[model samples]
Target: MGKISYYTEEGLNRLKAELTDLKTKGRAEIARQIAEARDKGDLSENAEYDAAKDAQGLHELKISKLEEVLANARVLDESTIDASQVSVLSKVKIKNKKNGAEVSYTLVSEEEADLKAGRISVGSPIGKGLLGKRVGDVAEIKVPAGVMEFEVVEIAR
Candidate 1:
């Protein structure tokens, strides 16, 4: 069984839209490329045909992987989540113990993690360390730089 990953409704919808595009427009483009390459010359000597076939294989593989992800994906209900501790979908504010730098991050699924948007994957090192931590709790996270301590300052939806 595939491991279940939780997502927000918007995230799930985005994935569905991408999958639809891949099955429709993406497949159509690949088919067009293959047909165009086939018209050029004999199959044995056609590098373009071979390349198109390879691209089609890769595209199909991507679609299959995405389908699997969607099959295992579940939409998380924000209303049921407890705001007292850090967990997936929780927006948490943490302060670096050494530098006193504060940053807010929303813990999300690996697929939905966007550092630029302040969304961190729950599977990440810092996210793992912060899991289940309440306000005022210190999380000792082992990052590439070394162990860094972050104090949980606040937790919200």
Candidate 2:
């Protein structure tokens, strides 16, 4: 069963754009490569042909996977998301208990998860621990190192 993916309006648009690029532009590029390989020589012992076929297979697989994800995607209403507590689409501020360091992250869909952009996937360790938490609440997350505590400083939509 395909899991439903929740996404913001911009996120959904980005996914759609990616799907289009993969299906059209990507297909054209791979087809060109395949044709070039085919023109090289006899197919019976063509390593280039084999490599092209493999690459095409990979490209098709990626397209299929993205299509499946798009089929099950559900756009989230950002306005409906509560800023009172940490949840999907919520920007959460947390203070690391051990280091006294503070970090802010926005919980978003896996597709939109970018650490450099401060967006984390809901399934991530820190994200999971932060979910459903409110301001001033502490979440004890278990990592490979050990259990680390974090205090929820704020939450925003």
Candidate 3:
């Protein structure tokens, strides 16, 4: 079974659109490739046919994985998200305890994480440490480099 993942309405819609495209255009393109390879002749010695078959298997695997993700997805209502403490969908402002550098991030699911956009996955090391923290609370997060401390400045939705 796939793990359940929560997404904002926009994120969910994006995922659905991708899945639809993969099922339609993606499948059609792969079928065309396979047909072209088959027409190239001698199956026993055809490298193109072998490569196309392998690609078809990979394509099907991708479709199955996407279907599982969609089946386990749940859309979260942003307005209903609690901003009192850090949690999924909460936009949190934090200050680095060591250098006093401040940054803000929106906690989202793995699929919706875009670091450039200030969105972080709830499963990330920093996000995990920030979870359930109230304003003025400090969180010590362990990353690949080392442990770092951050102070919660604010939380919003």
**Most accurate candidate by TM-score:** 1
Candidate 2 segments whose C-alpha is farther than 4 A from its true place: none
Local distance difference test values of all predictions, in order: 0.97, 0.93, 0.94
TM-scores for all predictions: 0.99, 0.96, 0.97
Write model 1 residue lDDT over 29-123, tens digit each, in one string: 99999999999989999999999999999999999999999999999999898889998999999999999999999999999999999999999
Residue-by-residue lDDT tens digits, candidate 3, 22-97: 8899889989988999999999999998998898899899989989999999999777767799999999999999
**lDDT of each residue in 1-157, candidate 2, tens digit only:** 6999899989999999999999999999999999999999899899999999999999999999999999999998878877788989998989999999999998999999999999999999998998889999999998888899999998877
What are the runs in model 3 whose C-alpha is more than 4 Å off? Answer: none
Distance from true position, residue 76, model 1, in Å? Answer: 0.3
The per-prediction tally of clashing pairs is 0, 0, 0
Residue pairs with colliding backbones in model 3 are none
Better of 2 and 3 by lDDT: 3
Q: How high is the lDDT of residue 80 in model 2?
A: 82
